[model samples]
Each structure stands twice: as C-alpha cells, then as structure tokens.
Target: MTTRHQLALGACTVTVAALTSTLLVTPDGATAATGPDRIHDIQGDHRISPYAGDSVADVPGIVTGVRTEGSAGFWMQDPRGDDSPATSEGVFVFTDAKPPVQPGDEVRVSGQVSEYVPGGADSGNQSVTQLTDPTVDVRSSDQPLPEARELNAGTVPETYAPQGDPAEDDSIDGLRLRPDRYALDRYESLEGMNVQVEDTRVVGPSSEYDDLWVTVRPDEHPTARGGTLYGSYASQNPGRLKVTSLAPSEEGFPAADVGDQLTGTTAGPLDYDQHGGYHLAARELGTLRDSGPSPERTRPQRDGELAVATYNVENLAPDDDATKYERLAQGVVRNLATPDILALEEVQDDSGAQDDGTVTSERTVGKLIDAISEAGGPRYEWRGIAPRDGQDGGQPGGNIRSGFLFNPERVSFTDRPGGDATTATEVVQRDGQATLSHSPGRITPNDPAWKDSRKPLAGEFRFRSEPVIVVANHFSSKGGDQPLHGSTQPPKRSSEKQRHQQARQVNAFVQDIQDVRRKADVVVLGDLNDFDFSATTSALTENDALRGAAATLPEEERYTYVFQGNSQVLDQTLVSPGVSRFDYDIVHTNAEYADQVSDHDPQVLRFRP
Candidate 1:
C-alpha cells in the first residue's frame, strides 16, 4: 500500500555536486539526465526542478491520482522517498490525454522532466515539475496506495512565503524550501503527493467551475460567516486550499457554501494550477454537511433616513434569464431594503456581452427597474451617462457603466442637461450650495487614468429637501495584478497604479464640491475594485475628504466579496463629513452563497439629512 508513512525513506546520498559533474548541461543551463533516478532528486530542494529538461529512462513510482479533464495527467508517487521535507516525492506525468494509469499500479515511466509554469513565465507563477511525453509500463494493478499526508491546522505555517531575493527579479525559484517557516514552501514540498484534509471547513463557496476553497486552520483570520479573511497584503490566510475532484463526472462534485463542512477525509494528490495556486485534486471526496450559513438581509431604512446602496449586477443585461433578474430584484428589495438611491455597476448595454455597437443601457436598466417594481419595491427612476462604443473596458461592446436608481417617491434626481459619455462634469457653486454642472454627468471621463476603464458617474440628488452628491464608480479592475500566491514575493499589485490615479481624480472632484460648500453631502460609492486598506482607498479618503464605511465595521464583518477562499472588501461606500451619522451594512445576499446573483455583495448606507 502506498502511504505517507510507508513513503518515507532514508536520505539519498546523491549530492548536487555529484549530479552536476556527471550530467551534461545544455546551453539553457538545464541539466541532461545521467543523474539520480528518484523523484526527490528531480524535484531537489528549490522551487524549480533540479533535473529540468532532462530525459530520464524508467523512473519508478506508483500511480496515486489521475485527472481526465483539461490538461489530463496522472500523479505518481514513489513508495520509498528521500526523507528530506524540502523535496517532493511525487510528480505529475503529463500525457495531455487520458493516461491508461490507475492508482495502485506500480509503473516505470520514461519522459523528459520539465518545469511548467502555470500561467506563462510573465505571470510570475510558480513552476510545476512534470514529466512530459511519458511512456508508462505498468507492473501490477490493485495494489494498496500510499497513505495520504494529513494537512490540518497544526501542520500549515502562519507565514505565507519567504521574501524573494531582489537580485533574482524577486523570484523564489532559486531559494531553498523552508517548509517549517512558510506555507508556500510546505505546499511546494508536498506537491503532487497524496494529501488529505479531514473535516475541513469551506471558506469559499463552490463555483460553477466545480471547485471550492477550504481551510484546514479554521481560526486563521476567520470571518463571522466562516470564511478566511484577507485583511491585508501581509495576512493572506495561509490555511486556505482550493479543492477539486478527480473523480469521474457521474460521481459528482460537492456544491458547498461558506461555513459548510467537508465531513470525513477528502484525500488526493496536491496539484498546482493557474486558477487558485495549490489545490487537492481529490480522488476521494468527503461528504458535504450543511452548516446553515445563509444570505444576509439588512434592516430596512427608517422613514426619515435616506438609504444609498451600490451593487455590481455582474454585467446585467435585458436578455438575462428571468430568474437572475428576480433574484437580483429580491436582493435589492428584501436583502437591501430597496434603498432610496441605488448605484448600479456593470449595467450592460441592451445587447449585453454581444459585440454590437450598442451603448445605451435604457433597456438593461428598464428590466431591473421593472423587476424591482414586480418585487413590490419602488418604481425606480435611473440616471447615467453611457460610454462611447467599446471605450469603457468591460465585456467588449457591452458598454458597461455605473448608473443610479432612485425611488422617485422618496428622492428626486436633479436633471441638468449636457451629460454625456465623454464630457467631464465640473463642481460649481449654485445659490451658495455645491452642484454638478451637468447632473448625471461623468467625472473626468476623458482622463488618461480612465482610459479603457469605467468612468465614474456623478449625479446630484435631493432627499428630504437636502442635496446629496453621489459619485458612482466602477474603477479599473485588478485583472493584470499578480496573484497573492504567485511566485513574486509580496505579490505586485500593478493594477493599483491606475486605480490610485482614478481615486485621485474622483477625490479631486469631491474636493472641488466640498470647496464650494464645506459641509456638502457627498457620497462616493460603488465597486472600487480595491480593498478598504489599499492605497487606492486611502487616496479617496485622503485629507479626511471622505470616510470609508467598510473601515468602520468590525474586522470580521468588513468583507463584501470572497476570492480564492479569502473574504475581502471590493465594493465600498465612503461618506463625507457632512453626513454626520450613518449606518452601513454589507448585505451579503451573494458572494458567500453557492447560488449567487452577482460576484459582489451589495452595500447600503443609511443616513438622515
């Protein structure tokens, strides 16, 4: 039987000096085979394989797991492995097709050992050691497999990763693995090895992709709803692990929500991929136990209170299924209490994601307004400046932009003329009060910072005879930013630079309004696409111009979105000093649930004028 206990072996006497002297080095610095025949020797103690680019003949191992979908491969582990904790005993043999290998089959494979970076070299992702173009010879079948290594709270380290050497372009590939210190190192050491987590808690809800995230260390930055919190750049919650099934399609993958438990042991080979870094490609999955974590609903606003909310409708279009519209409408009416003014993000053009030149979102907004009305909410009136065709970077030709939905009975939208997609709205003094030059206008739409990004929509509204300036923003996304678990240490947030500039532009616009009237009722809110603690948020709230509502909540309850098992804040509502007292709630009707209307959770702020 192959097992973790049975797989441990005495240290291999083969040293790097011995292998380097005997192996032929290619022009690219990769060693040719003529070295040790074991998997540990091929993996070495570093992130990159020591025997990379080498073609070895007859490497022996027992098949531990097989993945039949999407870059199909099989992981095999040597029952007897070197005792070094830094070196992995198992490796993936990429056949690029369904390999005729089964668990418990002890086989000899001949292939070229290569280091495959998951998302290309420029993505700063760690490389996976694999045997490509393999020829396998199975010796025996139905043998006992190796015992899986248990990954629990006590095993994973608190630290995420070690600092990369600056000279090596901040790449950790050349660094020696320190499994005792870093969580990444520990995962790397066990790459492709049979691993298991017993009674693990689901931190991220199962997606349509048939994968979910779990946490072995339940106490690590736990959210109120049983999620791992990604509080800062420093604390990435090392216990989180993505789980995917290697079982046949008919066996079915579990659809889990946050706080649910995967009862019993879910065991498989630990694999690395581009999506969520290291994950367990489980051959045997645990039973999912319902823990009763449900979507949240906020208290309705009082009669005198003005409620403002922001929801990224996740590219809402008129042609979407009726259920999607109904669900979103229920979230707005029931979960969010149908706020007096709702700022909508990603409201696509009438044609949705189709590559047509449609820029107006009247039908898109009309469908949502109709849904809200059908859900027994107010007949909401909307205002927005549609972007030029394909200028705003979202689904191409979708012309996704930020817009406002105001309950006409409760609030009134000041409709000054001349607002358009490309024109910039200016703050002006009108009768000793701050007012937008063009109501429902865009804020610096033509600025270079807003190039290929969603331009901020600034609108003037009147709630209870008091003027409120609300800037609805859906800033540039963090698409190009390196992953938190990427090879680069302290992973670079390159996408933040443009967001910072956008923040500054919006802040300046807000400052200009405040300059006209010191105590202006200004509210900047929407999907900022950055965290509350980020520099982009700081830039908006700089000089005390606005206070982030998320920052005021308890640390455990601040998150409005969950990504890669970590609860985080991507949407926010920042209020100005003029709005003295307010209550904010991140209504989690989505994000945390398996059935979601949007990827983001809508946030509401209630205040009396």
Candidate 2:
C-alpha cells in the first residue's frame, strides 16, 4: 500500500541558559519586551501570534502536558485569562528536549515567540504558534493542571472554514479567528490548548502509523458503516480530528476500526501536523470499545450474468508475506464470490520494488492465481502488457501495471498478437461486431496523458458467446494536491488536470469502439483516482457514452475508499449503454477495516451482455 507522508518528529538538544530577570535579546539582536504577561496576550485573536519574532521573559503557566518524544516539548496553559473566547490561553514551549517538569508543575519560561509552519511554508499549511529556544524555571511541582476544554458536537461549528481573502491568494492567515462561526477558526483558536472529547466515534480506521481519526460530531455526513461521508467539495466534514497518543509505545495505541468508540474522555493538547492538520496529541488516552463491525460480502452473480470486478491490490509483489496473499485470495473467493473477470491494479514486477531492469509480472500474477486456487477459487488465467522499466509513476522499479484475470470455465480471454507496452490499440469492426485490433493492448500508450503513469489496458472477452470489451486503468495519483484543511480555500487540486486528460482519452476510446459498432458492450473499470462526481468522472462519462455505476447507489453508500475520516469514491466501474440492465455493488470488504488487504474496496458489476 502507498503510505502517505507523515510528520517527522526529530530530536533536538535543549540548551539551558542562565536564568535572568533582565529583558531578553531577539534574533535580530534587539532588546525585547518582557511583558506578554498572559498566554492569551501572546496568542491574539488571529491565526498568527501578535508577539511573533519578539522575545518574552517570565511567561508563567501551569504545565498541562509534557511530550517526551519527537521534538520534545511541554504544553502550558495560564489559568487566569482574559474573558475573550477568541484568544487561547495555552501555548507550547519547544524545549527541543525533555523538559525538567511534570504535568502539574507551575513554571516561568523565557523564549522567542515564533510561528512554526507545519510542513513548511510552501506546503500552504497553517503556522503553529510556539515558544522556541526557551529557558525554563520550575517554580513548584504537583500543582493542578488546567481544565481541558471539551470539544463535542455542539461545540464544533457546521461550516469548515472561512472564505479566504482573494487578494492574498485566498489565504486565511491574516484573518481574525471566528471560533463560533467556522471549524477551522475554532481549531486555530484552540491550537496548543488542552482539549477533550467524550464518547467519540472512530470515523477512520486506525492506520499503521499509530494514529486514528475520530469525529466530535457523529452525525455530520455519516455512512452506513459508521464513517463520515465526504459527499462533495462544499460539505467538508468539520468535526473530524486525528488522534495520536502521547504515551509511550509500550502503552499500545488502540487498534480501532470504523464504528469503534472511545468510551471515556480522550484529552490532549490540540496540535497541528503535516499529515491531517489539527489533531489531538492525547495525554489521557481513552479506552476502545469495538462495535463489532465486520467486513461485508456481495451477492454472487446469478446464471446468465457476466460479473466483472476491479480491485487495486496495492503494490502487490511475488515476495510479499504469504498471509497477505492468502487474505487477498480469500477476499476474492469468499467476499467477491469469484467474479467472472477481475481487473487487478498495482501488480508489481516480479522483483517488487527492487530497482532492476525487470519489467515482467509473471511471478506476481502467477502467485496470486495459485493463492486463489488454493483458496477454493478457479484457476484463473491472466493477460497484461508490461511497461518499460522506470516509466510508470509508482514506486521506482516496481513497474506497476494493470492486468486482467478471467475464469476459463466461465469466460474466455480473446488473445491477439501485436499487443505490447508501447503499442496503441485500435477499435476494429469484425463480422458486424466491434473488437480490439490487439486484445490486451494499451489505450494510447504514447500519448502525453499517459506519461509516467499507468496506461489503460484494454482486453476482449467472450462470455456466453458474446464479446465484451473491458478496459482496466490505474490513473495518476493525487500526490501533489493541497489538503482540505490547508490555507487555501477550496484547496487546489492540480493533480486533477492529468486525470482529466486521461479520462478524456479513455472516453474517446470508448466512443471509437461505439463508432465501429454502435451497440458494443464495453466495461471500463479500475482505480481512476478521482471521485464519481468529479470532473474526471464527468469527462469519462460525457455524451452518455458510459454511466458511472457508483452514481446508481444512494448518496450515503456511494463510497469505495476512506481517506482521512472521509468515505469517498476513488475506485469505479462505468458501463456503456448497451449493458443497461445491470446490478452493481461496491463490496465493502476493505477500506473501512483496520486490518485491510487493500486500501480500496473492490467494485463489481454484473450484467447480461
């Protein structure tokens, strides 16, 4: 599976300077003011700190939490604060190492006020206000910690963020925070403060990175399986919060799945990171109560039904663990019910990610076929053209490509010569039927749209003596897109431009086949890496050439992927008008589970062609 980027918490040495009551020196060698007497004064009513870049001395607070790992620091909150809800009373002291303090120790800190932007400034993320290069003086120990502000459904706002100023490139940095109106502003207003949520539901499954996502408001765009549905760009769910433990690794983070509930209060400092923006670094972790949500299985295809399915077995290789291969095989056999034709994406080369000159996936596909047979499925045959070395834009040297697996007992793959990696396939008329000139060929392999990306593989199949054209695609990923909680409003999706071009090319290919024979039965399926309601899907289904099967389901059940607490649709199956009578299902065997074989849920479309 493709693991997303995370915040790298590195260690730094904390320098202890001699304690002095005199005014401190700033980075510009200027004498700084010593009186920002309260934490609320330092953290003004805006996102950026009012006293940034100046050194302040003797800022007193009670240590709310002590983080001993990853840029070791402590969070302190002033008990006595001005009666302004817009300004927070807590601040983080970046000591660069383990500070000599406990959770309840009252102390005075001297440091330079700075705005450290998570993921750097170019990432367009919001800056976190911090006190860096500190000199700490422990006044007393065992004092009471500040009361954590409770964050619940009623406390969080319905709107996600404020409309950014267009003159400043739609940036929300300079705007005054309105904690009552918008969610982002509320999170910013409580930025390094101690916060808590009671009886929260886990909307996103626990990832491998020892973190999980929970929602303060459970009813926001809820899925049937207890996940927040990210239906549209306008309804970005505002109550989602990522949770990571401040306890040691031996304490064990919860292995939570969707529908699991954090029974008690999960309290921590509200911190910002590069991965998911505002998250709670939990000091007082909650207990997990599993709601017993299991994986879902789709109904098997009936007689006279041609079932086609698509699964992105994330970066599958030959040398992977046998348990992974077995689980995947079981998902295909037991959960998917052995579809007549399965389109597999991310089938890596035989060497996996090793940077050799190898460009074949025989061992990879052969191992999966053996596993399926071992798991009581048919001995399916496979067909795919390998891409040139280092051309595809997956992990380097993986040579990830799409392939088709068909059951010979139910369907036959029509094999034709001259189908290779760089050869573009054409639609031809044969015996008053539309067929591919080269079966298992690529769709415009040399086109600039497919540059450094997986080319769509097209193959012909004969089921019940009827020819069906299938196109398997793994489009460009959304690696470079801006995040939802980023500084820019509406978030720039620059990666969609390439997917749009790819969709247009594939749509034109389907149109060409229809031109050859107007009633051709064509099925296009795979990980399109775009949403069903997005422009990419629109371009692929334009002019009524194809219809997105995902759109046929209810709005709440339309997702096949879960990303950052939002259930969405990234895998899709679109069919031509000739195959109008069909039953479609997105099998929820994965994506919602913490122990998943693949990151995406497989989608199946059964029809009589």
Candidate 3:
C-alpha cells in the first residue's frame, strides 16, 4: 500500500503575512435609489445567507456580520430586508482577503451580483460571479456597481446594465477581472496575464494528486451529498497562485461569509490537472519547518512486541527513481524504522502506459515493498486496501488513497467478509440514536475514482494466538478557512454532523471486529488528517472505541502537525478498548524523518499484544 502524507496542516502556517490589495473607487456622489426602506443590522443574530443573494455587487447593507476566516469573511444585509449569501459572483467580494475579521469592523462594498450553483457532479464550492469593490469604511450604506450580474433562480444572466464607464474593465480594487469564459478556456489565451477574477476559488491537487483533501459535510437538506468537492491538478503543469492561502468557507453552507474578501492577483502562468472534469493545480507554494527528527532511531525494536507508527509524509514522491520507490521506503525502513504494520496514504496506481511491461497498478507500493525486503523489514507482506477499484484512469482521484504493510511473522492474515465499515455489527451507533439492524447507515457511493482512493485498509492477524485487527485510514482535511458550521452560515449545525458521519464509519468498523471475535485486540492507524482535539476525533473516542497513544505524551510533544502558525497533532495510533493490557510509547521523529525525503515525522509506538 502507498503511504501519502498530507501537507495542509503543515503548510497552512505560511499565511501569517498579509496579501493586501488597494481599491480605487471612482468618486461618484452616489445616492441610494428609492426602494423599500428596510434596514438590517449585523450586530444581532440574523441568518444572512438566504438574504444576501449569492453575489457581492454593491448591494446596500450594514456590516451585519463579520466572520474572520483566515482574513475576514462576513455577511451584509440590505436596508431593504434582502439577506443573501455572499459569493465571489456578485457584490460579495472579500475585503482584506485574509480571515477571522474583528466583530464590528464596518466596511463598504461595490461589485456585480452573482449566485452559487452546485456543479452537477463536479468537486468545488459554489462557482461565483463578477463583482467590483474599491473602498469600505466603518459607516452607513454601501454603494453598488451599476452593472452587477443578477441571479434569477440559480441561473446567471449573460448581460447586465453596465453602469460607470462600461469600458472601465469591471475591476475589483485594482485587479482586472477574468471572466468564466477565460477559466473555461483553461487559460489558453489568458495564460500569462495578471488578470484578476472574482470568486475564483484556487485549490491544490486532490490528496491522490498532491496529498490534500478538504472535508465538507453534506447538508441534512435532502439535496446535500455529505462531502466537499474533490479535484486535482496536473503534476507537469502547476498553478502560480498559492491556493492554500485562501480560507475555506464555513462547514455546511455553500456561500461566502458576508464581506468575505478573496483577492489573489493572478501572477502569470496557469497549469491545470483534470482527472475527470475537475481542474486543480499545485504550484506557487510556501513551506515552514516543524520539530526535527528524533535522535533515537532504534526505538525499542524487539522480536515479540509489535512496534507501530503512522505519519503523513505530505506526499512522498521518488526524488529520482520513478519506476519504483525503493529510495522512499529505504529512508523509512533502513534505520530499523519499519513497524510491524505501516498504514500508508497517497499510494498511486500505475498511470502511464505499460512501459517496461509492469502490470502492477501501484509502482510506488511495489518499490516500497521491495525496499523494505531489501532492508531488514523483509517479513512484511501486503494486506488489504479500501476502495480497491475506484480509479479515474490513474489520474489523481480523492485526496485519500490508503493501504497497509504487514509483517507475516508477527501475525497471519485472517479471513473477514468485505463490505463498507458502516454495515459492521461492532460499528458505533450513529449519534443520539440506536441501530435497528433493520435501518442501515447512509452510504453515498463515491465516484469510481474515489473507489481507487478514500477507503480504509483492513487486515486481521494473530500474535501468539491473540487475534489482532488493523484498520488504516486517511480521513478528509479542512478546506478553505470558511466556517460552514457556525452561527452565520447555512446548516447551522454542520460541523458536528460531519464528525458524526466519520465517527459512525469508524465506530461501525470497530464494532464489526468486536462482534466477530470476542476480546480481540484492535489497532487503528493512519493519517487521520484531522487534529486529535477536533470534533471528529471526539466522536470516534466518545464511544471509548480506541485508546490514544499521544495522550501519554506531553502537550508540547503531542502534536504531529502544524497550522494557523500553531502546531497540533493530526497523525495518530489508537488501540481498541483492550489497550490497558499493554504498555505503549509514542516517539515522533518527523524532524529526523525530514532528514530523508519525507515531510512527516514517523511516530513509533511499541506495545505488546
């Protein structure tokens, strides 16, 4: 199985510096058009989405709400009781373009109006319309640009009443707007132009593409599908914009926060990676360093005990050897670093034409396996992989494509029926409810490519007659900094809902194992891609399903990843409820692990079954 380490939490810290913009609003002594005299204040609790009408054009309203996502993303309500969701399409343009705005900062906005239409099956937040804004001050009414696009239902009108200079270029601040026509063209002609586009949500390649997948919970609303849009960019071509720099929208809601400013100048060059119809890029990146590797390389490596570890290598690629990742595995295994069982993420299936007549779908995995055997970890063998067949023809599919590496001597593979984790008898019951066996949990089968990605690696083994189960996984990560499950966005209770789904899947799997074998030992390992303190982890641990190893370490040593200029733990290893019977220790060596080619520091947990 291929091990893919996510770089989101690691790279998110580069945003400490501000990427500011200057707006030169034309001096027009503008007065409000006589309309219904309705005033909305953002100081109190008034849901702003349904009213803001998915656009950031010059719609008049007070700074009713200010949500600081990375920069500042908030909502604006009109004096006429018109409360709509703010988006890049219309008057809803990001101000400061950073996040987490101060509660009561007043500002003015001017731009075209637009709406958000969920792509039929594409991965991404709502596509936005064009809007222009210059100045925002702490004050009364905001002005509207004469020609903002209007959303009639979910459809956008081709033409608008062009006000101002008609030929003024419809610029936001000083950035020249690039129309959807340009993007749909995939930058054929607009390639090297410093054009600015409103609501252009730049993103990195999917996990399978560049080791990142943002988690977005589908809404409870009948139409919601329970996840964020999945996309990928080309490895050969990359984007110039720093996508990780843009903040994510809040949990469930699909609109930008009112007054949300997303301003990133298109610095020449555009590279696109489209596996299906999804387009993404991974270029123009910024890096930061975390804790160094551990000094003690030989961490309690014994014969009978099981040494386990998990790390998000942030997408470990063969520096020079592409046909096989012998070197990649060498860095991880040679220093007596091999664990009895290693769960890996971002294992790519062979994509290129059948060169040299290799039939293996995953060259990376093959290389790693050979390298391990070449090293002392020769006893380890292949176990099972999740989503075994989902593949977008070898293109980057979901951000998570995980598998497992096992040592046959430590344990022998046992038989277990194959199916989704939600159906297992031992799985945790959905939150606030009991399972009826009659009513199975919800399972939205992902794209075929997703099948190739996003599945847990499961295997059974016996350590001296004691049956042990290992489930390796790589859950989704947080996308842009928008708050989907907050007081302001849609689906006010989205954050918890996502946690419940992930929790449900994990719980069910654990339960299944328990049901089949009484008192069996279970070890769950992989790059959860989520922090240990998050609601997702809370849900998984709430049932007391597994015992965490990091909890044994100090707060400073507990973290495995960093974000928002802060460090936190995301990679972890948890044992089933029976963990109290064994003694365990967690040794993080990513700093030292970095000395190799990988970014994630491998964590070592030595324990007795």
Candidate 4:
C-alpha cells in the first residue's frame, strides 16, 4: 500500500447532488429503472420459482394485511377503484425493512412477483415481491415500506424504528417474507456472465455490510448442496431474509441506490424448514458494474518497494475521552513520516461498543489523512478496526482500538478474518482479561474482569500485491496494583507477571500467524511497552518467528521509548523471515522526544525484497 503525508489540513467538503427522475443511462449506457418500471402482475395460482434476474411492472397497492407484530414486514393488495381501499383481511409479508405504508395508503411499488402457498402441501398463491426503495411514487394514502424486521426468533433486538407510523388499520406487520434467492447456472463464474438465479434479494444496512457480503462469498459456500448452483451474495445476510423480491434484467441485478450502480444478484433467504436444515447458499446475482475505479495518485517512488513504519501513540484518547484529548488539531504528528502502511497502537475508536458514543479512532484516522495531505504526502485510506470494546465492566465509555492506517490509493483490503471489519480483530490480536502481579508471583485470577485485560490489536493488508500484516499493540501496563495474600500491598512481581503474560500472548499470536500463512510477509510492530532487552521482547524474539528491527539498527540507536533518565527500547518493529530479505531498516530509531506526544518514538523501515 502507498501512504502520503502533507503538513496542511483543509476544511473543504464536497457533496454530490441527488439524481433527478429522468433516467440517466449508467456508464454501460443502460436506462435506469424506476419504481413503476419494475413491478409485475401475477395470478394467485402461478408457481413463483423465483428468478434472480426477474422483473415486474410497478403497481399501486394498499396495506391488505400484516402477519406478525414487533417484526416489521407486510402483505399488500391492489386497491379496488383507488378510493382508500380498506386494508386487506388476509395476511401477507411486506419485504422492505422500512415500512412502506399503512392501510388505505396508496403507493406504486416495483418488485418481482411471487406466489404464496398458504398451506403446507404447496398451496399456490401469488404475492407482490418486497419493495426495495422508498423513492417509489407515494400518494396521499400511500407511503414507503413500513416497519423494520427485528427478527424471526428474537436473537437480535430491534434498535431503531421507521421515520413515521403506518396507517392505524395497516396490518402488514409480521408476514414472514423470504428474501428472494438466485442460483447461477454456471460454475467458475466471472463478473459479466449471464447467470440464472431464483428467489434472491439484495439489501444491507450499510455500504460496509454490502462490501462484506461481496468478500465473504467464497468462504460462505464452501461446498455443493445437492448439486445446486453456486454464486455470490449468498452469504451476505445471514439468518433472516426479511428482505423482499428480486428484479432481474439482461443488464444485471439492482441493489441499494447509490449515485452509481453496483451489480450483484438477488437471492431468497435460506429456506430453513423446506431445506431440512439451514445451509449456506448463493443465487440471484446479476452482471457486474465497473468496480469503482481506484483513486489515482502518482504511484509511490518505487512501485514494488514498501516503506513500513510503526508508532505507539501513547494513551491516544478517543474523541469522547476529554476535550483536551481531541487531538485532531495535532495534525499527523506520529504518522507524519508516511510509509505505504502505518501500524499504530493505542488508536481509539470513534464510537464505543454498540455505537454508545464517540470513539476517537475514526477521527484520529481522519486527522491523519488530513495531515498526510498537508505534508504533501500521497493520500491514503484505512481499513479494519481492532476488536476492542471500551465497555470494560459497564464503565460506560467508548474504548480506544488498535488498527491499520493504509493508503487505499495504493492498496485494497483483500481478506479480513471473519469478514467483520466493524469489530476488533479476534483471531489475530486479542484483548482478554488477565490478573495482575507486579513481581515474580503468579496472578491469583481473583477478579472476574482479569481474564479480559488489555490485549493487542492486529490486522493485515496488501501492499503492491505483497502481504503486509500490521500488528498494533498495547500490552498490560504496570498501573493498578493488586493486594497480596493477607497483605496490604502487592509485590512488584505480580504486575510484572501480568505484563509478562501479555507478552506471551503476543508471542503466541506471531507464532500462530506464521503457522498458518507460513510465508507471510509479516510486520509485528507496535507499542510493546517493554524494552528491547526485557522479558517481553525476549518472549517474542526467542520464538524464531520474529526478528526485532533493533537487530538491523546501528549500535546506540535502537531505543524507541524513554522514561525520566531511563531509556529503554520499549517500542520495537519486527519482521518475519518471509520478508526478512526486504532490506528493511528503521527510521527515527530513538525515542528522544516522548514527553509531549507519546511514551514511544515512531519507527519506520524502508526496504525492497
């Protein structure tokens, strides 16, 4: 990945105007469909096999009935003579997560057509597919999709509600709707192939959710089920398809309305009961859109070469920590020396667990990008958040997270373990509870929270097609003291061992990465909070899985963190044997200035393999 740094920060902002009703042909020169162009008419007895790329003409409907309450989805009915038709007496499912309209409300909706088989033995009845957008025509009595579906069985609790209320008589509350599904008729499919699909819908809460759906497709369908067809978008949403119908076209599938189109397929939620068991499936995908063009930049000086740096932004408080900690004003002091990738420790998130409040990590990265541009460095983007939740024991505050700051212009995220870019990295770096013992004594594991003590954060990214795994860490520090057995004070060994255990965890993580991606071009860099010669460093370096950057440093210049009259190489940069020959070496190898900014110095290594 490429990184840049500029010393100036700009407040300039740009927003694109919304698209008008006139259809602007997409870049591929195709007319965009509106609500009216997509809905189709169907008879009750039609057997809706669910075509992923199927389309229907738009039609006006009234809230005929709703199935369940608390869970929002609906059933619709065509108004008779358009005079505020009464809500239907029969029940149905409304597909949109957002409630469309109340009973008596008149609206035009476009979605695929499907038949509802009321009773067990395939009672053939046809129904209008789910509404995918709110921009559809809504007259006085008409509204957009109404009510959000919280869950079918209640594992996830609903958090927010639609902007307005449905008609008092609207009964389309709990009609269990199947997210339309699709099946690609081919194997080894690429982007633009004409594929066939059945009963699949495309929808997600956010762009990130959609991106995760795209990337995790392969892993979700690792096997063939009864020789059924395989395709992408199968594993995007798990568990429920409260999602509605699919609109297929010779062009491709339609998804969330961005100014631009993203080509993906539609698929129904996995059929739990009919399929006998819940199995991952994929279908209803459409042709591809140009993957958004990569942001352009002057390629870094040497295309294949990488400049790697690691920083320990000591106690970097999140935005909500305190006004004084709102350090966006500082520019990119720590990461000013831009490299293709910057591994940082003590990075705080902008929001706490459950979007509780402002976590500083996002803001920190934003400021870093600003600083990079100001310093005249290449523009960079970031990916992945460390899996840290600041809610330590109901402390009620957002927690700082560790993570990677990458230049999207230079690299793109390829693989993210577990496809969870929202949470901290669990498989790579961990923050678990740990007991404290300052001296050489073992922690008694007394407190329940000890097992969940501070853990390191780690993630990986690709730089110029080369894997660069950055690990940001904040190990157990010697702060809180635990009382000794029947004694008023804890021996120093107790805390030391606690920190030692933290180091051991770091050591094992490095070993584990090597064990899997054996040839991984790994950079185990972070704020270790222990000296170069300390037990922590020893634990990591002794594993043969890691070699410290200090080994590549000149004598008298390896220290990165300094204390009052006490200088130690607490912060270190390390490389694995995979990239050992990259000619790597550290910059800012000494921590001479740790007073104002942080407790450690920022280190960089420039090398070419």
TM-score winner? 2
Residue range 317-429, candidate 1, lDDT tens digits:
88999999999999888999989999999999989989888888899999889999999999999898888999999988788999999999999999999989888889989
Per-residue lDDT tens digits for candidate 2, residues 38-156, read 88999999988989987788788898888887768999999887888889989999977677678888877778789998888888788889998776766677997788999988889
Report the error of model 2 at residue 171, Å: 0.6
Better of 1 and 3 by lDDT: 1
Stretches > 4 Å off in candidate 3: 1-298, 313-327, 334-336, 352-362, 386-400, 415-453, 480-496, 515-518, 583-587, 591-596
TM-score for all models, in order of appearance = 0.94, 0.96, 0.46, 0.40
Which pairs of residues collide in model 2?
A: none
- Output the worst ten-in-a-row residue range by lDDT, candidate 1: 9-18
Count of steric clashes across candidates, in order = 7, 0, 88, 104
CA lDDT, every model vs. true structure? 0.88, 0.89, 0.38, 0.39
Model 3, position 427, has a per-residue lDDT of 38
Best by lDDT: 2
- Which portions of model 1 show Cα errors greater than 4 Å? 1-34, 248-251
Q: Where in model 2 is the C-alpha error above 4 Å?
A: 1-20, 26-30, 248-251
lDDT of 4: 0.39
User: Per-residue lDDT for 438-501 in model 4, tens only?
Assistant: 1111112222322444344455556665555556565555443321110111112344566666
User: What lDDT tens digits, residue by residue, belong to model 3 across residues 1-609?
Assistant: 223232222111112222132322233744333221122211111112223322222233333333234323334333233332211211233443542322233344443222332232132222322122322333423443112121111221122111122243221212222233122222211211112323332121112122221111111111011111111111111121222222232331122111122233211112122221111121122222121223335454577777665655444333336433554465457543676766676655454232232223355456667766776565566543323343312324322255566677665655445434233323333332222221111122242212322445555556666555666666554432222111111212232444356555776667665555435577777766566665667666656777677677654455544221123456777777765654444343332221334444457666677
Model 4, position 78, has a per-residue lDDT of 48
Task: Give the Cα error of residue 472 in candidate 1, in Å.
Answer: 0.2
